[model samples]
Target: MRVRPMLLKAGGVFVLLVLASCTLSGCWDRIEVNDLATITAVGIDQYSDNLIELSLQIYTPPQGSSISMQGGGSKGSSSQNQSTVISATGINFADAVSKVQEKVPRLLFWGQNEVFVFSHSAAKQDIAGHMDYILRVPQIRGSALVFVSRTKAKDVLALTPQLRSSSADVLEEVSNLKIGLAMSAGNFNIMLSSSKGTAIMPSIEIMPAPEGQPQKRYPAITGCAVFKDSKLAGYIDDNITRGVMWFRNEIDMATATIVTEDQGGIISARLNRGRTRLKPRISNGIWEMTVGIDTREILVQNTSNTDVAELKGTRIVEEGLKQEIEKRMNRTLQIVQKKFEADVFGFAEAFHRKYPKIWNKEKGNWEEIFPHVQVKYDIKTVIVNPGKRTVPTNRMEGEKG
Candidate 1:
């Protein structure tokens, strides 16, 4: 009996000791926040003599006194100066990053990075090389938004805007608004790796500040950069970009303005919701594609004297809206198909799904066949609402229809 009791006490003491040892062990990979340079954005450019330039936007915390004073105690000062831009050059992307690391006092950390930008020259020459480095990095997030700058990408990072602390914040907020196609690093990689190996990324440019304003310039996401075979092919304006969006079934929101000749005025409608469908068919060995668009819009502004609440008035306005949409779609198709000869739209995927046997045989020559593929459009538009008033308040007596 005495031996049994002693054994039980020894076992209990061993269990306690194991638990205490677990709690006493310290984390081996722990890093203090104060010793890190948290990167918010990255920019890449091509330099002469086969070199690469890397730029980083690192967040810098305010002084201790400034922090305490602005910590809910004061409203006059703002935290707009929280980031700084630094640059370095090397033979390749990784080498350039290493050189940048040598210059930075603290360890460069990319876990907080939100934006990646490439200059036009860099994008045209070796965007794929840049992307490879970004994908292989363990600390970098795959969801970081990507852009191509018309000017030197480093210039974009150096901008100072009154609304946001850094250019990265402004670009990220705008991307979320769905005004244009929002693509991340992962999304670009997938698109480039697909069967077609074609992709598009939002393009940014510097817009001069308003005349007589204190600020020199601001950055704007204006258009798209189209890629063919993982290389930059060309760029398109906002109007053409929207047309591409329509074919991809990616339009989140848009506004259209139509002028009514019969009513002698202009009307504006806001797109509420929209959906697109692509039907692929082969007739007598000829590839034909029919695009169907179903969209709903609300009349937000009626400058004409026509009462859109009436059925006849609504029908007239609806027809005009349909024609306007058709025109945009046709123009976009002509440009992407006939002019650019690139299938940024995933028409190849649709064909692959419907006719796998034929797709496999011709997948290699899709580049040649895509430009000749006959396309047709069928669009339907409905006027869901006519706003608060049926007619314009500023309508003249003679303008009434």
Candidate 2:
């Protein structure tokens, strides 16, 4: 009974301290929504004079319309000023973003931000350096998506998307679709932190607007940004990008078009799944890696053959596509290994995993040895459907019966 009373008295003192702190207001890190500005999207481009072109997309309360009545009132196509876009040129990201606040009526904020883009020049010069602001900021969420732009980041964000309210939101949704690599701050950081291999971020390009269309245009995901030790070595086309995805086993819905053997036509195969197995062997001091890829595919569209109108013909198409896919994948792997001399596919990681002791000795000579690494690709494909109609969807007008 004496011990119980002493414990209760101690707990009472802790409660009093907690209440006192709450009454004294928040801690030193306190920041309110209205007092601080929100930044929706940020872009960085390299300027010639040791400067940077930084662009910011800030969310603003609807002008001439209340928040509750947004997109619901009887007005036709509501007002245009939902958010603000600003760009500044300075020596760094912080300097540029700070300049933007001078002109904008509303305070700049980044709480609802979604995307961060770096121009090709910025990425090539130094991507990690320019992204320092985003990495350090406590308010800026680490989940924001990242991209490399062909043009200035500001020009890309100025586009008026017909569907989404924010261009940043448009890209956020696209990244989840997995058409390309998942590129966010967290993902980029992880890849940078990886030991053996480097990370690849998707490249964004702006399409020319048609005559009478808007001056600015929405950015499109074009290809992959190849990075070697936090710096961009180069970029690859879509075909090479797809090939890289094959090695990583990230291909879920890729269409492969193959030329028919007997007839001069094209057969497009839709890949359902791609599974890859990499095995490394040391033969007489020469490292050999076998890259076996098995894939399941279906016939989506055929533009070449006509005489073969049976379901059995699908099997023949499958085999042809399998060979074509395999050949292309082999070519890509060979080029990257021998020509680019960069291991973008984690081949080094696989080698290090199995032979840790041997890898340690070989690590010093990896760059010289990587170009000579032998890679073998094996691809298998399967066709599932031939549309709802089993027969040919199109028929010749005057056929000789």
lDDT of each: 0.88, 0.74
Give the 10-residue window scoring lowest on summed lDDT in candidate 1. 72-81
Candidate 2: tens digits of C-alpha lDDT, residues 16-112? 9999988799777676665665777888888775888888877765554554376466354343645567787887778887787787755666777
- Top candidate (TM-score): 1
**Candidate 2 lDDT trough over 10 residues, lowest sum:** 74-83
lDDT (10s digit) by residue, model 1, range 178-201: 889888999998888884558999
Q: What's the count of clashing pairs in each model shown?
A: 0, 8
TM value for model 2 = 0.83
lDDT of 1 at 113: 97
Work out the TM-score per prediction.
Answer: 0.92, 0.83
- Residue 117, candidate 2: Cα error in Å is 0.8
